[model samples]
Target: MATIRERAGRWQAIIKRKGYPQQSKTFDIKKDAEKWARQEERAMDAGTWADQSAAMQTTLAEALVRYEKEVTSGKKGADTERVRITKWKRHKLAQKALGTLKASDFAGYRDARLKDGAAAATVRLELAIISNLFNVARKEWSFEGLANPIEAMRLPTSKNARNRLFLDGEEARLLQALAPAARGEDGRFGDGCANPLLRPLVQLALATAMRRGELLALRWENIRLADRVAHLTDTKNGHSRDVPLSSAAAEVLRALPRAIRGPVFPITPNAVKLGFVRAVERARKRYEAEGGKDERMLSDLHFHDLRHIAVTALAEKLPNIVELAAVSGHQDVRMLRRYYHPKAEDLARKLG
Candidate 1:
């Protein structure tokens, strides 16, 4: 049953049904209110109104908040994702109802974000999280018929893959710069306390090709000192693999005093980023201070470039990609190739 009345110069429609909850709405005119009531009542009678009811109470911000608490909190990269979700919560789209989102809304967001100097990769990742939310809502939260708006939108093209490798003498310069910074006058890593970790950290990264996250996550229990293998319980690809440590890499680990039982290197990811950036700046400054020209100084180097150097070196020595994958944790041969950037001089030697 539905009833319409004029209340404060507006038509108010109150609908009641046997199996459904009571619905109420206000319209400028009685006819419009009556039309809405008729359509809703018909849809309810035919049992085709779940789409309207399922996501009516929940907004994208509310869903994402719940997701972060329930799902993203359990992830290894939870802090990073929590930050991204915080940004998402500030967007206008987040306030919209979960089922009310359209692809065109996101197209506008993508354009706006790009105009504001956000990278294509950053926007794509943001959209991916949104898509993940829709999938979770549909499959887990019972919001059926809700389509992922990302599927309707086209994503920005990703630029060329980074194949940055250490230039000649840059590796030595990085170590030289880090050597003094990792320690104080008393000689230590954290606030000049004890056991400076940067030199060993950089060396192990080159020798083992381990990611910054993997290195930071490493525990003493995971490292088999006798076998010289680091057991990774959680990798980026969601699979575990045993990484064999070279003698040099093993030496670095063996030298470090195990002060904490949880993580071998208890450092934040952002600390490593800031540390690397500072190291590069110091390295470049030192190089230019001497006879070295400004152009000759390593200004474009990144810490991850060490992984590329390690992979290419392994590719030169190792017989096959399978062997290289064991060291680098790359699941695909093509992805492994991206890291296997052999020096032109090394290739030129083969040509002769």
Candidate 2:
């Protein structure tokens, strides 16, 4: 049985049934209140009623916290995912209860973030984490009644892939700029760079095409100097690959003082990121001041761009996608091609 009555100028529906908990809801209209009461009662009778209590109790912030501890912490991208989760913890959406979260709420968040200047790709990644959290919350965390609000919500279009590759001579100029500070120079260095890892990091990246994470995670036990192969135990795709080191790359490895139990590079991701930024700024400023050719400073060069350059070189030499995938450790050929930005002038030479 259900009771519909006016309270505070709104209709309230309260349902009482045998073998089930009492359910109550308020609506602006009497008809809506009646409809809801009937539906809930019928669902209870049919054993299809979802207890809204759990969803109401859990919040997005709480969900993310649990997900991070129970799920994301075990993943390889745990650090990066934690950063995203933390960002969302401060978001308005995080304050909303899980039960109250609707597709409209997620849609509103997407719109707000886009207007706030977040890229489509970045927002998409954020939303993906949210969706994953909801999934794990239901299937793994025993929040089965909690609905995935984002499942049907429209997502932003994927961003155009970056094709930013190094122009000829740009790499040399950039490395030249990085060289001085990497040596041990205290003041106004032509060579004498300070950070010992900066020069070798850049050079090794160019040589092996390893990602920043992979480079930072590289160890002595993984490297065989005589065989010219570096065994990556855990790569991005969960599969290990033997990365063949070039003679130059091997020489760079030999020159580096080995750490007995620590990583080869021993640089944090933030350090590598900040160091690269500083290196680019100094390189650009010095090259322009010295009346360098082409006047194009390595303004946009990133550490990851070195991977792009390496893949492009490998694509040219590997004869086919399989061989390129082997060297690059790319699980998918399509993904591998994304980094292989070949020169237009070289392609045009085939027509000649």
Candidate 3:
């Protein structure tokens, strides 16, 4: 049954069905309301009209909770999904009913996110998560004929490959400042609370080009000391990679006292970050004291930049391009190019 009501100087068509709950939509005129009622009544008679308003009552937050439990766990990079879900829950979209969400609503959400000063890459990632949720709802969860509103919305262009790398002499100075053992009044190795684990971690990162999570997750069993390779099973690319060890890298690894527990780098991820922060602070203080103009040299250098340093070094040192790709575990040269820069001598030789 359908009924028309006037509320706040506008006409609304309300439809009540037996199996499903009631649904209502506002219209400008009585004829439009009557027309909609007739169309809905016919669709209901044919058993084809889905109660979209009832479906929409399921909020985005509720869908996110279901998605985290049902879908995200089975996928690659589930941790990333967890983070994305958290972000989505914080957004205005989370409060809206999933069924009532239109293409225009999503467009408003996108625009709002941009206005809030979110980077394009961040917005794109969030949108991808939302899009994936709708896809799951439609195909897997049996939300039949429910169109994805986000598909119709335009996305902002993401900035790729920001040139974050270590400048010359910065790496050496940073390493030098990271004391193996801080001196105390008694001048003992264990006197001060300097992290003995950090030096080897830095060297390994500069040698292997491994991500922070991969390095932190490294186990003693994965290390092939004789072959001079570190086997990385859990990687961003979802492929196991074997990172060859240089002599300097090997020496650092050999010097590290073995941990009795699970992880080779047994420090907490937070501890690792805190240690790096402290090291950077110390390095910055030293640089300023020395009257260097390049205060920005080590300021912008993240621990991840060590991987860039490793890749850049390999590209500059290795004669064969294919050989470099194999060792670095880069499937293509596209990403490898960003890290690689020819030495001044190599450039002079090429000119000659």
Candidate 2 lDDT score at position 333: 88
lDDT of each: 0.82, 0.82, 0.77
- Residues 1-352, candidate 2, lDDT per residue (tens digit)? 7999999999999987777678788899999999998888878878888777667888999988888998898987787788889999998889988888999998999999899998798899999999998888777777757788889899998766655688776787667766644323554534434567878998998888888888887899889888999989888888888999999999999999876566898777777777788778877777778887664457666777788888877777774678788888888888876646667897799779
Question: TM-score per candidate, in order?
Answer: 0.78, 0.82, 0.74
Q: Please, what are the lDDT tens digits per residue for candidate 3 over residues 1-352?
A: 6999998888999988787567688888988998988897898889887656534667899999999999888865567668779878987878988887788877787788889998787788888888888888888876766778888888888877555777788887777766666666786654222887887788788887777778887887888788898887876677888888787777777888765446778776667667787787777777888897875777866676677777777777785667787677777777676656667897799889
- Model 1 alpha-carbon drift over 4 Å, by segment: 1-14, 27-42, 51-54, 180-195, 281-303, 338-352
Indicate the worst ten consecutive residues by lDDT in candidate 1.
Answer: 187-196
Error of 2 at 211 (Å): 2.1
The parts of candidate 3 lying over 4 Å away from their true place are 5-54, 102-118, 172-199, 259-261, 266-295, 338-352
| For model 3, the run of ten residues with the poorest summed lDDT | 184-193
What TM value does model 1 have?
0.78
